[model samples]
Target: MSIPPGESAPNVSTGELNARYDKFVVDLLGVIAYGELSAFERLSSDARYSPTLHDRAALGRMAVTEFEHFDVVRARLAEMNMDVELAMRPFQPSIDSFHDRTRPADWYESLMKAYVVDAISGDFYRAISEFLDQKTREVINAVQTNDESGALLQDRLKKMLADDPRLASRLALWGRRLVGEALTQAQRVGTEHSFLRGLMIEDELPAARNEVSTLLAQLTKNHSRRMSQLGLTA
Candidate 1:
């Protein structure tokens, strides 16, 4: 249950709020660390599908960077006195299921998955970072701000689409499907984790609902913009 609106809710103490915030930070870090680890694995696997040696090497580099990001978050979790693996375990199923359902069929689809799907997740993390403490916020900002992979993916995808305009329709459909699966994965995570849910809501039901709606809208808009960047319809 959520915190009820106005007088209907019990008064919450400073201690309670601090504890809640601490749990939220730990939960957030855990999920991010797991996500990076998963990305590293996926990108490493995806590299084998690369058409050229240069592309394979580029993906290998990106995968290494992903592992580096995972280590950063893992260290933060350690500092919080949290068991890193235990903290990340709860999120594994939902994230794994998302990837299983949306596994790409080819190199082009893989590129779209890497670019569109990962960017939306990054956007979500950036949005949530607004509500976290300074140190936690800094950690998230540092890891999420990686531009080399994004730039590389964008350049390659744009050129691919330009070279074969016929691919646009298929890739656009793939992008839409990926976003749908991603949202389902996110919903499952939020439902299972009350502390994460608490971070997204307010003390009032209506306001909280509105906040969530606004956040989804913003995410969708950003996704559409990303699709347009690749010359695809969202």
Candidate 2:
């Protein structure tokens, strides 16, 4: 299922909505925390594939940033008196599967994967943040700010593509594949996590369905623009 817009919880009392929203926040943070942790590991692993010492170190820096992001989310969960490990556990399998299936074949593929996939997920999180409480929104915003990996990946990929126009076709295809798998991953998470699904839609209303379609359209549009920036097809 596509992510629906941030609509009020339907057919619930204020207190009930509050409780549901709290659960939603925890679930959101849990998934994002796990994602950051996974990114840290993946980038560190991908560093070995880097063609230059400078590139390897750059990836190492990004990996550290990801872990720092993870730590921020972990602290938030702890403050909520939630078991951080338990909160992140449910998302582990699906997220791990995503990485396993999309593992890059080479340095260029790794760069594209890191850039395109991370941006898509960031967009999704920002979209969901609209309906969250002020404090939770601040936490989400804090972790996402000052991300330099996207810029680094974009610059490197652009230069690489410019030097060898032949890579455009292959990378474009890879970008599309990454988006496809990302949407699939989103669907899996939404299907499996009821509270997270509740944040997006309410009781399966038609308007809710339309909102979901709109969100998906926006994500796709943003993704296509990102691909264009990288001189690739969406």
Instruction: Tell me, by TM-score, which candidate is best.
Output: 1
Candidate 2 has an lDDT of: 0.83
Q: Can you tell me which runs of candidate 2 are displaced by over 4 Å?
A: 1-11, 145-147, 195-204
lDDT tens per residue, model 1, 1-234: 333212132476555656666777777888899899999998999999999999999999989988999989988998989988988998898888888999999999998899987798898888877766678878898777378889899999998988899998899999999988877676667657763455433455466556566777888899999888877899
Off by over 4 Å in 1: 1-10, 195-197, 200-202
Query: Which of the numbered candidates is closest to the native, going by highest lDDT?
Result: 2
> Which ten residues in a row are the worst by lDDT in model 2?
1-10
Residue 169 deviation, candidate 1, in Å? 1.1
| Per-model tally of clashing residue pairs | 0, 0
Scored by Cα lDDT, where does model 1 land? 0.81
Which pairs clash in the backbone of model 2? Answer: none
Model 2 agreement with the true structure over 1-234: per-residue lDDT tens digits: 323224334565556555666787889899999999999999999999899999999999999998999999999999999987899999999999999999999999999999988888888888777766778888888777255678888999999999999999999999999999998788678668863455543565465556556767788899999999987888
Write down the lDDT of every candidate, Cα atoms only. 0.81, 0.83
